[model samples]
Target chain A: NAGVTQTPKFRILKIGQSMTLQCTQDMNHNYMYWYRQDPGMGLKLIYYSVGAGITDKGEVPNGYNVSRSTTEDFPLRLELAAPSQTSVYFCASSWGMNTEAFFGQGTRLTVV
Target chain B: GIQVEQSPPDLILQEGANSTLRCNFSDSVNNLQWFHQNPWGQLINLFYIPSGTKQNGRLSATTVATERYSLLYISSSQTTDSGVYFCAVEMAGSGGSNYKLTFGKGTLLTVNP
Candidate 1:
């Protein structure tokens, strides 16, 4: 079974362009998160959802938006891409609080 | 939010050698995890030891919640083990609403043959 699946494994966007990073999980997890990892920097949380229709901002939520209309999907939207936003984005999910998280392969996005 | 720190920042070991990685947190936490990001940039879950100890083959991990620290032990290191090790934690929050994980800068490891 595919634990966590992320689409657009790689992408390039010009400044001010917009795109969405799609994430899906087959494991009926209740908690889903979006994180971005930059060079020499640790993964920074962007947004997370406790469950369907329940979303919350994380450490870095600017320039991004998320929606969880269904338990199986949590998509991250980039309204205005910037060079600073060019980083590897990862999608993760867990059964619930205090559980091990499963991460997707990650999407490599480069904004010019 | 909790603060996570990992050391010794960098490590180099020869094949068949053993090494230990450490992670320290600034506050109490309800969840802690260790991850290995390979050169290919794929993150692989190493351990999910919030408390006590867990072992898997050549790797093991221990978490002392009361001390706000954890240790990861790798035995008989191999070239495949070269990667960046990261420690992440989720602070203990009321009603479990605050579940965001804070990660350390990470410890870069290189295993030479």
Candidate 2:
């Protein structure tokens, strides 16, 4: 099974350019999350959604936005990409609160 | 916000040596997991033990909920074990609020042949 999947293995965005990172899960997990990993920094929660039509801001959601329109999809949008936004983005999903999370291979995004 | 702390930010061990990695959380967590990110940047599942101990091949993990700490043991380490290990936990109180995960800065392990 494709636990969790993310699109665009690598991406380069010019300053002020906007893009969306696609994430999907076939596990039918009720919980999904978005996190970014910078060099030396483990992983910081960027945004999350508990279910469809429900979204929440995480520790570092200032530069990005997320939408949970369907149970299988969660996309992160960068309105105006900046150099500081360059990082590896990971998508994860869990069946429940105390369940194990499955992560995607991740998308390496670079803002130039 | 919960704080997860991992010890020995950096470690170097010989192929035949054994090592232990520690993770301490500030608050109660209903969900705890350990992941190994290899050199190619793939996060592999290791363990999901909130309490008790679980073993897989040469890797084992123990989590004590009462003490809010966890320990990961690597036996007869191999060169492939060289990478960053991360510990993450979900707060018990985060029920339905969101699916946020708190991650530790991770411990980098380098196993020499």
Candidate 3:
């Protein structure tokens, strides 16, 4: 089974452009999260969902929005793309919140 | 939010050498995990040790939950082991609603073969 899958492995967005980073999992996990990692820095949470229809803000959620419409998909939306938002985005999921989270290969987004 | 700290922000080692990585947390947690991020940027879960020790191949990990510290040991390092290692922890309760990961800056290891 594909644990965590993320699409658009790479992308470049112009200023003010908007796009969505797609993530899906077949693990039947209740917890899904979005994180971004920059060079020389650790990953920071952007948003998380405990389950379908339950979403919450995370450490860095200013330029992004998320929705959990189904158990398999948790997509992150970036509105008004800014260079500051450029980084490697990862999607993860776990059976529970306080457990090991399986991560996606990551999406490298460059905003110019 | 809990605070997690990892020691030796950067490390360089020769092939066949050994290394030790440490992680310290500020609060109590029933869950703590170690992950290795390869050059391809995929995070590989190493272990989920809340206490005692676990060994997998040349890699082993130890966690002293009572003391709020954990250790990871790498033996006979190789160039493929050159990557970032992270330690994360989460508090458990109320069906783990307190579940949010706090990650350390990570230890960047460069193993020269």
lDDT of each: 0.94, 0.93, 0.91
Q: Write the per-residue lDDT of candidate 2 for residues A12-85, one digit (tens) a residue.
A: 99999999999999999998999999999899989888899988888889989999999999999999999999
Weakest ten-residue segment in model 2 chain A by summed lDDT: A93-102
lDDT of 3 by residue, A1-112 (tens): 9889999999999999999999999999999999999988878899999999999888889989999999999999999999999999999999985677888999999999
What does candidate 2 score on TM?
0.97
Candidate 1 Cα outliers beyond 4 Å, as residue runs: B95-97
- For every prediction, compared with the true complex, DockQ reads 0.72, 0.76, 0.62
lDDT, candidate 3, at B72:
100
TM-score for chain A as predicted in candidate 1? 0.99
Q: Model 2 - which docking category?
A: medium
Candidate 1 chain A: minimum summed lDDT over ten consecutive residues — where?
A94-103
Task: List the pairs of residues colliding in candidate 1.
Answer: none
After aligning candidate 1 to the native by TM-score, how far in Å is the CA of A43 from where it should be?
Answer: 0.8
| Top DockQ hit | 2
Each model's TM-score? 0.97, 0.97, 0.96
Error of 2 at A24 (Å): 0.8
- Tell me the spans in candidate 3 whose CA falls farther than 4 Å from its real position: B94-97
Instruction: Please give, for residues B54-73, the per-residue lDDT of candidate 3 as tens digits.
Output: 99999999999999999999
Chain B alone, TM-score of each model?
0.95, 0.96, 0.95
